[model samples]
Every structure is written in C-alpha cells, then in structure tokens.
Target: MKKTLTGIFSGLAILIFILSIGLMISGTIALRRNEPVFVFGRAVAVVPTDSMVGNEPDSLDVNDMVIIRKATIDEVEIGDVIVFQGVNGSGNPILVIHRVVDIQDEGIITKGDNNSSIDQPSYQDYVSNDNFQGIFQTKITFLKPLSQMMSSSKSLIFGGLAIVLTIMLISEVIHLVRTYQDEKNEAIKKKHEEEIEALKEKQKQEIIEEILRDNQK
Candidate 1:
C-alpha cells in the first residue's frame, strides 16, 4: 500500500509539473507573438499598468493576474470590463483592459476606472468587433506573484526550466529510495533461505544416526 501510494503521488506530481511547463512555454510564445494564449476558451493575463486601480472592489491593480473568457460583441454591455486590441501613440498595436462606458453604432467607448477622462481617440479608434478579445472573468490572487515573475519571456523560460529540474531531482530521489528498499528485501530473503537449508541438513544427519542404532539392535 505504501508503495502504491508513493507511485500514485509521484505520477500526479510529474503530470502536474509537465503541464505547468507546457503552459509557461505556450504563454511565452503567445506573448512574443503579441497574442493571448487561450485555453479552453479562457485566457490569463498579467496587468502591467495601474490604470484600472480605483476605490471600487473589482478595480485591478498592477501585477494582478486575471482570467478572461471569450465573448462576442453582442454579449458586451456597458460597465463590463473587457480586453481589446488598440494602438499606442506610435501606431503600434497594444492590448487594453478597461470598462465599457458606452456602445455606439461604430464601436464601444472604454475608460479606465482610475483615469480622469476617457481613452483618447487614437487608442480606441480601432476598437471594433474584430479587435474584441474577451470579457474579464475574475482575478487569480495566487498566481499574481508568478505572473509578475514571468513578465518577460526570458524569465518565464528560466523559471519553467528551473521548476522542471526540481521535479526531476525529486523523481530521481524517489527512484533511488525504491531501489535501495528492493535490494535490502532481497538480501533478507536470501539469508532466511540459507538458514533453513542448514537446519534441514542437521535434521537429516540425526535421522540417519537413529536408523543405524535401530538396525544394530
């Protein structure tokens, strides 16, 4: 039972470790391509700016990890926080997460919770149905620190590899322990068999002596 439990736990740990590495690798690739890594229609993002920080309970702070789910334009409504693709002042595309204040025939208007005014025209000019990404689901408090650590592609890769190495080391230790136990058990078994053989020989010699005495009588 103990061995079975150990095997089960080790298998689960390795499975989880592999899955974590896969996520980190895929996430790094997606970030490099300037895209979100979607998993089962959901994507996780790390907040880089404090634009959405406010007194509201749901306000997002910098380094917060959030989960977003895919949504359609028609499903969007006023006051809903959404992620969309926008452009910066230099015409470079960037992702923006803010609350939708209004929906117009052309597109939607979004504003940060803590910002003094609405987003500039340049930023939201390209915010259309095609640019819509997903709707905010909830913040993941536990992953906030990990998300912060994985801010860059290099760090993400390094952290992932480090974890993989750690898991491998643990697995090796378990394997060594099992090997030692098996060897110890085999030695004990051999010693018991040798002692039994010696006892059988002694018994046979005593029986022969008794038979010779009976024949002499």
Candidate 2:
C-alpha cells in the first residue's frame, strides 16, 4: 500500500513537471509573438482588471486566473463571457474579457459587468470572428494563489521545477540502491544454502562408509 501510494504521488509529480515545462515553452513563445498561448484548445489568463467585477457569483476579480476554451463566433451567445483581441486607446492591440450583450449581423457587442456602457465602437469596434480568442469556461480557484505568487516572483516557477527534478533524481537513486542491496542479499543466501547442502552430503557418505566397514568385520 505504501509503495502504491508512492507510485501514485511520483506519477503526479512527473505529470506536473511535464506540464510546467510545456507551459514555460508555450508562454515564452506567446511572449515573443505577443499573443495568448493555447494548449489543447485551452488557454489560461490572469485577470488584469476588475471590469467584470459585480455582485454576481460569476463576476471576475483582479488577479483571478481563468481558463478559456477555443470557441467560434457561432458557439457563443448573449451573456457568454469571452476573450478577444482589440485595440486600446492608442491603437495598440490588447486583450479584452467581457460579456456578450448583443449579437449583430455584422459582429458581437460586449459590455463589462461593472461598466456603465458597452465598449466604444470607435475604440474597440464590434468583435468579429477574426479577433475572437476564446470563451471563458471557469476560474481556476485552486491555482489562483499560485498564479499570483508566480506573477510576483517569476523565479519561483523555475525554482519549483528545479526542486521537482531534484526530488525525482533522489527517488531514482534510492530505488537503485535498494534494488542492488536486495539482489546482493539474495545471492548471499543462495550461496550459504548451497554450502550447507554440500556439508550434509559429505556427512551422509561418511556414515555409509562406516556402516560398510562394520558389516565387513
């Protein structure tokens, strides 16, 4: 039972390590290209603003980590929260997360929950299928704290990866040593048993010889 539990935990650790590496690589690429990185049709984002904050349960807060799934324009409906690429006041491209208020023949109109009015058409324009990123699925409640920590200390992530690798290395070394010790002990036991068997055979032969001598006399 202990070994089984160890195996399960080790498997989880390895899986987490692999996921971390993939995220690191993908994040680096996204940074270079200035775009969100999606893995397996899903993307994670840390909320930068409280525009979606409200009294509702689904309202988003700053620093919250959310999971978004790739979706088409047809897959979204009114009131569905979505992430899309838009331009800021300075014409610089930015990502916006808002709830769809209305769907028009031309494009989709979105408004933030805390905002008084919909996004300005001149600034953001109507969201079309071309700039649609994904639909918000849910907030990552468990990893929200971790996300904040990582954002504050970028080195923490690499430090965690290092620790995981060290642990795995130590586990492998210990396993090898134990395996070698077990094999060595088994070999010693086999040799000792063979020696005892040989000694018993010699004594039996001597007894037989003694019996033969007595019979001859």
- The TM-score of predicted model 1 comes to 0.58
- Cα lDDT tens digits, model 2, 3-62, are 987996698678667766766786676645545666556666777677899876667988
RMSD of 2: 12.7
Question: Candidate 1, clashing residue pairs?
Answer: none
**Which residue ranges in model 2 land beyond 4 Å of their true spot?**
1-23, 150-217
Q: Which tens-of-lDDT digit does each residue in 149-184 have in candidate 1?
A: 776665673464345334444566577669988999
Write down the lDDT that model 2 would get. Answer: 0.75
Runs of candidate 1 with Cα error greater than 4 angstroms are: 1-29, 152-217
lDDT (Cα atoms) of all candidates against the true structure:
0.76, 0.75
Question: How many clashes in candidate 1?
Answer: 0
Give every collision pair in model 2: none
